[model samples]
Target: MGISPELRSLNLSNNHLEGPLTVSSIPLQLQSLDLSVNELNGPLLLDIPIPEQNFSLEKLLLADNKIEGPITASLGTMTSLYILDLSNNQLRGNIPDSLGNLTLLTVLRLESNHLNGEIPACLTNLSELVMLNLASNELEGQIPKELGNLAGLASLHLEKNNLQGLLPLSLAQLSNLQVIDVGENNLTGNIPSWIGTCSSLLVLMMRSNNFKGKLPPQIGELTELLILDLSSNLLYGEIPNTYLNLAAMVVVNEDMSVVGEDRHAPSARRVRPCGAPSGARSRHPPNIRGITPDSDHNYYGTCVDYVYGNEDRRYYIEGLDLITKGSERHYAYVLSGMACIDLSNNRLWGHLPAKIGNLKGLMFLNLSRNSFNGDIPGSMGNLSQLESLDLSLNKFSGKIPFQLGSLDYLGYLNMSYNNLSGVIPQQGSHMITFDKSAFWGNPNLRGCPVESWKCSPPHSPLSPPTIDVKEEAKEGFSWYELSMGWSVAAGFFAVVLVLTFKVNWRKTTFDQMDRAITFLLGERTN
Candidate 1:
């Protein structure tokens, strides 16, 4: 297709367009190009020979394509570019250091590619950056300490890489940061206490790392934090009771308008196509800009034609991997009102804080495979929104609280391999749905679902009558014996009275008895 120099925006996204993109195909005045979600292959070669000052391109989105080869260094010449997303492509080789020159860049996404080598420290020179996602790449070496210099940065994703070393203390300077995911790396050292200082943090993930030491109580200071995943670490010690201070987890927020709003003021302007770039001489502006012309020789701007203003930019949490319902679920973006805490697979020990019930909004909680002891807190029932709970493989003792049966939203529960005893909570609609496996390995625990572990009836005011049939029979026998004795005595007294009153009858009876005796004696002699 022939290009128009007047074309300012070209969005051919989600098409079957294949083959490499050429520099000449892009219009000289094009300010935005979106060819994402296509089958485009071959190296992304944009070697336009336009003067740097005259180049007005601002947004280039080619994500989710099969584009390969090293990122062209000439892209660095586009000083006006602010949003560059080349993610989810087959792009290989090192990230061009020349990208650091795009000082006006706000959002840079180079993740899900084969880019290797140490992260270019010069990339931190983009002071206006608001979101930096370099995750899921083959990058090595320590995270740049200079990243703290990007004061406006809100999200930092360096997960799923071979990066190593301690998280730089300088990162504590990121006051506007809302999400920081450095999971699945070889990073080591104690999780810094200063992390609590990032008060704006909403999601903090450092899972699958080698970090060790007692979890800092200061982390509880993040009152608005919704998701906290520090699982699969070497951390030990009790969960701090101060976590009750996480107020966001304690109450559900129905209004998600502010959920992922940019902490930094948006710098991108809302642009519209204006009359064929001023110099067109036609009586009617040609429909070359892919817009329909009106009777007055003018074209109206559609919602899709403009940048930044087309959608709600506030709902942007790139991706998250969380374990819920006994499996890993990848969330494209965190549910606005969801809250979770995963501290499993650690050495954390001691009684779980009874105050955990304060987090009524918590949806997923995994404290399994720890050394937590003491009775499972009945207060957990106060978590009206709890959907998944895993407390298995612990040292907890005592009866599973009947209060848990009140959780109407509970769908997945695993309390197995603990020292817990007594009947499983079976009153709720959800609690009974769980199978025997949810309570397996607890030798002392007894309930209906556990095959051979039948629970004995508890001694409560509402318990059924326990009177034995044998005891009732024994009591009846005693009454019968008394009645029989009384009847025999009465009959004997009556017979005595009769014999005394009827003397004639008594004499006759005696004579007959004497005659019978004499007859018997005579027969024996014969």
Candidate 2:
């Protein structure tokens, strides 16, 4: 195939292109190449013919392909590279330690591959690194303590690996970190208290691990935290009411500007398309380099160039997996505006804080499979934005609060397998939509809308007083009956008095009575 030596960018993604990619075919001047979502197979050959010093490639995306074999150390020679994505491929073997040489690198993604071995401590050498994703690999061993050196790191994803040992203490140095997912690993030990020091944290997931101990109250200091998932662990102790300090969860209008402000913006910054003439002015302001500053570009930093022509490829970077509505759901760009707390499948016990209602912006809450007891906070009705709530398999007992009937946005609710009793709330449009399953296992609970369980009707001021059958039978007459008899006798006396005083009326009545009596006598004689 013939190609222009001046070519600076080539995007042929989502095609049926197959066979091994010939690194030598890439142009020396190429600054961006995106061949993602294709059938490209065979070992990735980074032995490009161009001299490393002259190579201008700044972005390389080969995700979602059939590429295999260990990453070539030669890749580190691409000094100008800032974005490197090889995710969702069949690549195997250890991540090349030489990759640390890419001092200008901002994003490095090698997830969803068979890469093994301990993470190279030298990776911390990339002082400008913004995002590092190495999840879903065969990696083992403790995370490197040197990682704290990457002070600019904003997102770190190491979930679904064979990692072990306690979280590194150095991580507290990451003041700008927004997301940290170390879930589904063999990590143990209590969650570090210094976590609160990272005040900018937005998502913190450490579920499905062996972590045990009381939750640190310091976590409540994360006023900006949006997602907090510590589920499926051995953690015990009641949740701290200090969680009410999560300011981001309390206000419906979240400050999304914090998502990628350090490196990019959630909103796409307009810029010239790759290969656009350098002298040409774009309709929007240019970003660092010619690249459009997008959350996907600078946060996940996937090597896709989206600022081309009429196409605005704003991609949501998958950041979390949360169990919602009885299934695991992937959260991506919307994570910025999402507020959720999942502490289910633990040994936590106690009444939820009534102040929890202060988190009016919370959207998902799961406290199932715990030892929590006592009445569900009626203050929960204040969560006007709540969409899903799970409080199943607990010791909570009491009447479901009628205030819950006021939640207009509640869509999924599960309060089953509890010690609850009394009528299920049946007022809100959303609340009435729930079936009996929502209140199952609570044998004491009764009401319509949950099932045909017999429940006493609510009292009304206009309703007549109830009568006791046994008492009425013993007395032979009720107050209601006595009142009726008195009314009849009073009417008779009043009529008698009126007839006696009014002689004309008295004569009229006597004449009518005499005529009726005479008619009756005649009929009988005949």
Candidate 3:
């Protein structure tokens, strides 16, 4: 019961197993050992207490533990090792250069650790290596060009580090390469056009860098590219129209119905069986860990758990940290059904292409803080699955199209600081709820919520004077009064004519009238 030399496999995963793995306790002939997802802590050493002899260990999975100390060089003694995962632990110091001695190594995951120092150039010696993940660490320095020698390499992750320098041209030699993420780094220089040579590339993230120059039109060569983010850089020039040639986005957009019914439906993470690509050696890229595949199989399986906003979700083999809907978000496993192109905060200018609507499956599109002008293409309304749209701080003009209101899944929208005008259209509940702030900065824009000015009816300069017919009719006399008035007016005109013709006759008539008045008064008295 003390020690069984015949022991070949040991699995203590998903337990409260703690304490250091003592070299004296492991069998010299052990081939596979899995102590993942536990509280296992203490120094990581490769001494197997085999009395000057090397152990036959092949696979070691010690992820999600508290293991600490330098990744020891003695690990090179286990030349039979193919998979080595020590991720999500407190392991520190340089990755042992001796690891390059394991030419049989296929996967090496040291991500999510405190490891620091330049990635050992010797690692390129592992010609059989397929995946390499050294992300989420304190590692720095230029990537070694020798890594391009791994023709079998498919996935590489050096994100969230202090790495700086231009991409090595040798990377273009890896004909089988698929994913390359070096985001959140200090890297500079133009993104090499040679990247387009990686025909199988699915994702490329070089955001938050000092990279400059125009995005190579050759990027459209990545027919399988699902995500491309070069945001927060100094890149300028127009968005290449060549993006329309991206076949992956086109297919996904056309067959969106096959992906999900509700474009905004929450995706559920599912565990699936997938292995390294055929002809590949490891289960995952070298920098990732936490794979607990059974010893009987050579395939790799990943379990992804994403904490998005207020919700916690578990999904399958991928993760992304992107800024969408005006906030940073982490996505898990949903990456397969997601497509995005973020070129925000650049010096780009020119009209947004109407063909952009062709990427109907895109979930996020951010072209903010650019100098792009002209009307926002009406075709953007075709993006029914779009959840975020940012066109702020641009020089775009003309009316905001009514079609945008048709986007049922749109959760965020920004058109401010543009020269856009016209009544803001309230086409749906979601659109109606957007405040004036979403439309502000447009000087001529008017309507509910965005009522900086009132809308008025059209007026004419050459118009007829208005007449009050009713008032004139009310002031006019009736027929009887009109007749009496006409007679008095005629008598007065006749008398005036006679007095003008005969002054003497006027005096006689005056005397006769005086006498006649007196006679009339006397007759009345009688």
Model 2, residue 21: C-alpha shift (Å): 1.5
What C-alpha lDDT, on a 0 to 100 scale, does residue 263 get in candidate 1?
28
Write model 2 residue lDDT over 409-495, tens digit each, in one string. 788899999999987775433455687799899999877656653222335366554565569868777776788899999999999
Runs in model 2 lying further than 4 Å from the true structure: 48-53, 254-318, 452-526
- Give the distance in Å from residue 474's predicted Cα in candidate 1 to where it truly belongs: 14
Question: In angstroms, how far off is 36's CA in candidate 2?
Answer: 1.0
Ten contiguous residues minimizing lDDT sum, candidate 3: 281-290
Candidate 1: which stretches are off by over 4 Å? Answer: 2-6, 48-53, 254-317, 452-526
Residue 395 error for model 1, in Å? 1.1
| Alpha-carbon runs more than 4 Å astray in model 3 | 1-11, 27-31, 48-54, 253-317, 434-444, 448-526
Cα lDDT of candidate 3 equals 0.74
TM-score of each: 0.76, 0.76, 0.71
State each model's CA lDDT, in order. 0.77, 0.78, 0.74
Q: By TM-score, how accurate is candidate 1?
A: 0.76
lDDT value for candidate 1? Answer: 0.77
Q: Which prediction has more favorable lDDT, 1 or 3?
A: 1
In candidate 3, what are the lDDT values of residues 403-448, reduced to their tens digit? 8888877878888899998877653535555667877789887775
